[model samples]
Target: MAFVYDLCVVGAGMTGAAAAREASIIDNYKVCLVGPAEPKVRKVNTGKEVFGAHYDEARIASSTSSKVPVWGILAERSIRRYSELEHLSGVHFYDSVGSLTVGTRNSEYLNKVEKQANSQGYAHSMDILDSQQLRRKYPFFNFSSEDQGIAEENTAGIINPRKMVMAQISVASKNGCDVIRETVTGIVRQPDGNSRVVTENGRLIMTRKVLLATNVFTEIHNLLGDIRPLYVPMPQTVTLAEISPQDATRLRNMPSLKYRGYGEPSWPSDYLRNNNDQIDFYMLPPVRYPDGKYYIKLGHSDDILKGPLQVSEMQKWYCGEGDKALEEQMFRLLQRLLPGVTFLSHHGDACITMVTPNSQPYVDLVTPTVGVVMGDNGWAAKSSDEIGRIAARMIVQSDWSYDLPKHMFKLYTNVTGPPPASKL
Candidate 1:
């Protein structure tokens, strides 16, 4: 029988969905997305897919444990991509305000951040701020001169993440790609080299090419080890705290920041993002809490994310319940940061990010029958949409060229040959 589709993308997160949506723009090729059964099914029995929970202190600890340079660089790349993608996806990201850093005089990580910004050709706006200068600019900080600070003006801001993912999926589907909401059970290659995706319902679909944008779970099967893919799944946590419209405005106006950490402060960097009436204080590194447990509720806490910081180490935590625990930590952290705000409802979300060893993404074809775009380390604010468009071009075009920088394809290998000669 003829192949069922030109491409099959596993995972419904930003990467997989982006690949599928963009593929439809090609001439007459049929593309299909074989992903989880449901992207947002909140069944108590069904566990978290890509994201899990946000723990304030644990993540800060996690950040300090490994190479801080990697994280800072990824964040910088994300900042640059924001402007380039806004017009293409019609997604609005708030890139107006600068990010403030409030830490100690000898803060190690923040200085590295400056170096990263400089190396990436983005050091133009970073301003070193003393406590007095910070106070003069925004009195809300409530921090003193004992802290060393820097602000990257017009560098970083927030985007409506879930909404942007949906927009890409919408446009890609409208272009004629078939998006299937199903969990993949296994993958097998036929004699002709086409891939067969076995779904949870036992339905099998065949395709000429395959792309694995599965994020965290991508490593669970042949897609990673056999493919020798350069990716890691790390669980990250962010909190959603409900605030009065007035309180929310305070956070909205305030530039988000990373703080000068306390002991083991490495894992619990304070991140400031906002929901309508609430401020989201996300933490990483999954640390150990005061009670000496992995997670807890309503108490002095310090818990670590039980996973690896590098692609070398990764573990999954069902985030639905952990989300509650993470929210509690974020709220407590927020209370310490901004005492005046009160909360209504609090929730946590786990964002599993695919990270490459070098911190850049993998966007190239590794096999004759497969090409992929994966690994962003959760800096999807701009990279996701742009990467999707890039993946779309690589997968759908006859020439395998659609404006991707030449270096992007060279990342996976040194093979300097012409594009695949086989016709689609």
Candidate 2:
């Protein structure tokens, strides 16, 4: 008879890697993480390729999330462990340049951010800047007269998603966890009350329990048998502006920016004009990519593609360059935001994010032997470690042991009607 492992985590992205590490360290349990490595070159002709959003170089990391207060809590917990994980794995990925959130003065959004920051005792690490102060401090940025900023100087900055995932996997490998580099095709139940994870390479992994962190590909593979989670795969595009070395150095002190306001009359496109909640955008500081070039990345919160993508349509979308018109619009917006800045070149790429009905992650069990921790909703990269820890504890202890209400992470499946408007 073949040996049965204690737990098998399918999906080696940020959340899955963190869960594998937590499960291995919680006690003496045989754990394995299964997922394919990033492709050397992105090609859509190959029908066997799988892509993840964590293939990027920079993602904003801050304790203040505009979506909900619970997300902020998750970010704080994970940010507190970045240093420890770095030391343990010997991988440096976090940049502590701080983060900035800008919005209208005394607006509901900024008020909620201020309340959460104060309640979390972050007053000492935070600085509130009025419109004049923002202009005086960051002259390169242009903002309206009603805009105010909250600068988080500590535990808020940018993280390289690739390096972060590598760090977690390194720690887990040293803790006696097995790492399998393959794509999981499906998960099936066994006759002995266990689960079998099927891989694309014809390998079967038997375990007492399985956790699916496959993100956007979760529903496409039908891993949960007959039950399907109600999620929409929303397409997202990001534009990168390549600057010269001198320009990069000049903007070395720039912080990650999250802007919430309607800029100039010509800033928004027609799609943005129809929606009241579509004027939000985020920008990352200049980061060096694999090609050894520094580029500043920017993306909008609203979906410019205009429709929820079906699973079959995802591969073709990723194969092609993102919406060229939207990319041009973003480039123009960047130029206006930083007037007189020279951009050597610009390009865009396509990606997908899973949006749930309520805009929160579903970290619940699908059955007695199969569990799931997915539905990123566009905010999981910053808080993945804590989310993984909670999931690991739930599986290891056979119960939901986290302080957060279990219902907050409950699973929603087989719903009718159209999906709700995204709050990302």
In order, candidate lDDTs are: 0.53, 0.84
Write down the TM-score of every candidate: 0.68, 0.94
Give the per-residue lDDT of model 2 (tens digit) for 228-259: 78888888888999998888899988999988
* Maximum-lDDT candidate: 2
Which ranges of candidate 1 are over 4 A from the true structure? Answer: 1-3, 37-41, 44-97, 219-234, 260-304, 308-316, 323-330, 345-347, 351-360, 376-382, 389-424
RMSD for all candidates, in order, please: 9.4, 2.5
